[model samples]
Target chain A: MTEFTLRSNLDAMYTVFLARVRILSRYRGWFLMDIILPIFLAAMPILLGRAVAGTSMEGNFLKNVGTANYVAYMVIGANLFMVVSNSLWHFGFWLRNEMQMGTLESLYLAPVNKIIILGGVAMYTTLRSLISFFLAFTLGCFIFRVNPFQGDIGIAFLFLLVGLIPVYGLSFLYGSLVLKLKEAEALINIGQWVIGFLMGIFFPVTVFPRILRFIAEIFPPTWMNNGVRSALLGLNYFLGEWYLDLAVLWAFCIIMPLAGYYVFISIEKSIKKNEGVGKF
Target chain B: MFEDVESFYAMCKKQLIYMARYPINFITSFAIVFIIILMVILATTLFIGKEETNYSFNAIAIYGMILFMFLSDTLWTIGYNIRWEQVQGTLEALYLTPASKFASLISRVTISIVWTGLNCIAAVIFVYYVFGALPFKNLIFSTIVLILTLSGTFGFGFCFAAFTLYLKESANLAANVLQFVFMILCAMFFPFSVLPDSVLKISKLIPLSYGVDLFRSSLMGYPEGFPELLPVNQEFLIILLFGIITPALGYLLYRKAEKKVRTDGSLGMY
Candidate 1:
């Protein structure tokens, strides 16, 4: 057997990443759908606004959301939703697919650390999601006649980059649920929508009831969403300052992945001990 | 005729049993629709304000949403579900059985109507309580429009199943794309007046767009600027034709594709 070293582990991770990327490349239409669906999602609310509020849509939106640029706000929200949704889906579905294919057992027996393999998958998901987010945001802005270059693009990038870690951490937790329940599609579907709703995909969390707003504020995507929108569209951050809200996200960045990984590993070990990974 | 009816009943029972095996699927599907409706309402309220009671807007959105749910469920359960059977290695086995294929295809519609129908009723009730009173005008006509719209949608679903057989792996992506396309083209969540003139022109071209317009407009009691695509009589005529003709045409297309796949020995090649 080959000696397990850092170099070999790095190579294994790269192989896994490359394999996922290659598979995704074959499904070219999914990439296009990723780009198009966010725009469509943002359009639903925008059109509804036009239908209801008519000429005063922007004024009402400004009064409620603190940004007259509802287009950018929604585009940003939808793209960030895509990010969070994709992370949950790719990770959970990856696990479920492995289980179904009877490969999770073999993966467990592999010499490389499971976290390393997961890290590889997480990296691929992040790359795919960010690419889709950028393309969709740009396209949605153009389609809605909103200027894409309006705000602190650098800080917006910082928030997005910082926000992804916790989102993936949430995905790890979701993957653990998939392992335990063995019903990944329904779980991921509900998980994505729940996250989207809590994160205020098309509206400000301030519109939510007090308890709902509090619940929404705890999810990292909410901060990430407000961060990007505030940076781009001049909306106020949750904590009144960009850095303050980002610092909270930083706290999540540290806590969520650790908690998620611990829960995932615990569930994984329990499942392995009881029914084995290949049982699906 | 009796045997075909029995086969459809058995097939529906089998599908329901599979659904029962996954209780979470049923529960989450119910919850997801509510969450989605709430999100849309919250978003709309952001612009219209929470204080304003716009019953017409509520009626339009809710009714449009009901049809959308049926159409979406039909697309997935009836159309894309054949892809599931193909993946599970049961498509070929299913073909080997002596049961009627048309019955098997149509049986899936039972779940869409039953489950999605329940979800729609709950959604209307949920909206009524939360958003205040919604218009329920011309209920008898609205019901007829709904039934006709669903029959036409199921026919479209059959056509999509044929496309799935032809497209194979790409069918999943196609379904996702088509769902959104229909959402926009049909203006399922918004008034047709909000759609650009260009898009409205395209929306007028699709038969389902008429279904969406006439159903909601009649429910809304034909408010000004309602049924934005064509006159009510003309739109209903289109829906009538769509309901009467599309199922036979779609079934013929499905049978043609089914024969080609079986002959090419690719029925199980998912």
Candidate 2:
């Protein structure tokens, strides 16, 4: 009987997931738009290097970064940023969208607990982010003319996989803020830029000031991004060892998700006790 | 004319007073913009060449960033504010008033402008004090440039708000797109010289480039260069044109949209 009940709860959440996928599918142009923007974002740096460095651009990049292929380095950064950004947008700010749609309250009305609904949202976000990630990654690689599967692909994927749980968990904490605030535009807008900055999407965190570097280290996407770059581009890891970096990410995995979940649930309860999640 | 302006001022003041009552809302709104400006300043600083760079006016990038943030937040606030008011059912009460709706809307937007401008001023002081940037000396030119930029900004804001009246659901997307486009195309991070010639030419068509150019010229100490391709004082002319054209177009659009909704009796479609 308990098994049946758990299965039914999962099934109900899946329905919500499917509905979102279907709705997004109806707006197919958005997927293409996402793929295009990252290319342009990456192009600016590549072109700037060429313009500024002139004939010595390749040598300049090779001297600073590991690879002479700055194009590939930038493309990878942009694609990973797409993943990080979409995950946050889908899982974090999507709560605001849900509230505005009045579906947030409807879900809260259900017999299932808040965590279960969050699980459904996280699952949906994960699936969508990865889809966009793969599509943008592959297409961006094609545009930039580089092998997308170069270097320790398995280890890089492992970093991403571990990194995602914490990212989703962080998004839940961000979602809690949206719930309490009842409007998310300012927070989401500010947060994404901060995430992009801390992640060092265009450059390594080593280039940051000492204090900034410390702040960057605590951010999960910074580790995820650095790990991916180190794995793929043969860039130096922060700990001077790939395994050490991976272990730190794992530590973040353990701490952030639990901390995130606790904060989220607490905020959820507070919001419910006050104006509720449907306030938007 | 004075009465129209007075009524609009009164409406704007009332809204500001109401917002002041909710201290958190006002503080958070300003803080968010301030934070965004700080991020932009940081990003722009990263790419600035320490030596052997041709551009003398690197600080103009910071100015562009502040202007971009101010315009984007102010314009975005207009739409979202109206939507929030609509959701709160205060929009109808305001609409039923004897004062003109456009004036009232403009007044509300003016409040956003004042708040966002304060944030920008704070951002400028923070950036200058922290970075020790040289003081801008061309006060009169900078003032004219700011006025023109604001006029152009208000034009775009009015049009965007008019569009929102027809499609309320698109407000968030519109806000995001507007801000993104301004940032990317207007070269808010770096100099416009970084863009390809083709992209640069296209960006010239955007009203934002004038503000960027004027600010860069005044602060960074550039003489009226680019006369052959862009024309001398073209930024002023373009802003002047948009200042006259955009609000009129936006007003017409708003009236048409309002009429359509009234006929259909479905303003609350969202």
Candidate 3:
């Protein structure tokens, strides 16, 4: 392979980034609706808690969950889940959209590498997810009248920042499968709900069975959720220390992205050999 | 009429044969859908476990969700499959045939229904063996309920298919919206009781809920003192009503849309 130039790669990334921002701007209402949807989804549980537990809301919640601030806890989980959900949508479904619109083959014909284009896509998605997360988290706090940035804000951001690497990595793995299968919409639609469940978006992973808990822990989103909750709501960290948990995510950051990229490239090569990317 | 019937059957058989040639397509769709159903079953189990104080999803509740899922998988197939055919340039060729367009369209739906039924059969077998034999106490009643449920789904599918005739590219969007409606209104994963009072009331007005309830009554056994739940027999009445309502509207809309496409000369424009 030839030596890669950083400048050219950055330019390619920026080009892909601009394309995404422009497309997102076209569907402006849908983008805004996503930021609002998670808040409503989280509100149900908070209101239900208040209704069912009445005056003992804090006591009842703290008794089992070890957090008096169930509102903040659920908000963090939901917002983080929104990030996981949207990132997968961005990378996974975007490929399918391109294929459908006859753009995937066009991208394949370009001199620039697929990884550069994917890098740009990932950058755009991360930016959008962070914006949505902040909005939803802030608005949820305002609606529920709870402290949103109470616990270890810096550490929580660190976890989010690291957690995204593996999450996107896994998303690329899913994207490859979508490419091979050609059932992107159905897969993503069902996959999102399954992710929500496994990540314990509305409840703690501690509530899951032992086997389920083990599986959930392996998922990057579950770690992100727990880390955020631990940071914001003062919940117990899985590793019992903030640094240890962050370290695990950091390790995943190194391992998963490489593995995911390998899997995706292998699949793309095999596909190109047989039907070719243009077949879609 | 007899000639049309024969040609429709021929079209259906031809479509089936063409699909069978691509065994991977059918197998993968079946596997992906089965995995999705399995995930829903797990999620439903978790939701029920949180409240029910019992670990088991009664035969009715499980079957109800399974049926809705199966229907949801199939109902939208017509629109999406048509859209794919249109993309492949085969749809225009199909229209150019001597067969009645309505018969050809319905035949496409028949092909999809058969494929979905095969998938459902696989799922049912998986459930029976993996989850153990569900006590389906009223076998004959359950079959009637299943038939009604299938009819109601076909009704919704027809209404959706009409939209595909107008906006070819928007077929995927229509399918997504339909699936969302099934999840929200049908209350497949949770009881209607858990939903907001307003949502619950409106859900009852949708025929899919009655279909779900019918399956629940047959498979899970009717819940104690829950008069609001649609009985198996009552579901038959609702299904009959929807069977008339949706297909009539669907056929009308489809005819109007098809005519407009013909007049505008835009069928192959996309």
lDDT of each: 0.89, 0.72, 0.73
Residues A102-207, candidate 3: write the lDDT tens digits: 8898899988889999999999998999898888788888976878658799999998999999989988888888888776655666677678878887777787
Candidate 1 runs further than 4 Å off: B49-51
Winner on lDDT (1 vs 2): 1
lDDT (Cα, tens digit) per residue for candidate 1, span B1-270: 999999999999999998888889989988998899899888988787646657687777788889888888888887778998897889999999999999999888787689888988899899889878888899999899988888899888999999999888788888888888999989999999889989988998999999999999999899888888889999999999999888889899999999999999999897
Among these predictions, the greatest lDDT belongs to 1
Residue-wise C-alpha lDDT for candidate 3, range B1-270, written one tens digit per residue: 998999999988987997776555665566665554554444333323133333234353456556766567555665666667777777778778777876766787787676777776787677778656766556777777677667666656666766776767657655655675666567665556556787788888888787776666655556563324565467678877875676677667767777787688866555
Among residues 3 or more apart in sequence or in different chains, the pairs in candidate 3 whose N, CA or C atoms overlap within 3 Å are: B59-B219, B59-B220, B60-B219, B60-B220
- Clash number for candidate 2: 0
Off-target runs (Cα >4 Å) in candidate 3 are A1-8, A25-82, A96-105, A131-157, A176-216, A232-234, A266-276, B2-60, B118-133, B227-236
**lDDT, candidate 2, A116-209, per-residue tens:** 7777778887887787778878888886688987889998899888889889878877887777775475566567767877887777776678
* Root-mean-square deviation per candidate: 1.2, 3.6, 4.9
Per-candidate clashes, comma-separated: 0, 0, 4
Stretches off by above 4 angstroms in model 2 are A1-4, A22-74, A97-106, A138-150, A180-183, A270-280, B1-7, B17-57, B83-93, B223-229
Highest DockQ model number = 1
- Specify the poorest-scoring 10-residue window by lDDT in model 1 chain A: A67-76
Lowest lDDT block of 10, candidate 2 chain A: A44-53
- Write one digit per residue (lDDT tens) for candidate 1, span A34-140: 89999989999989888889998888888888888888888888888988998998899899889877888999998789889999999899899989988998899
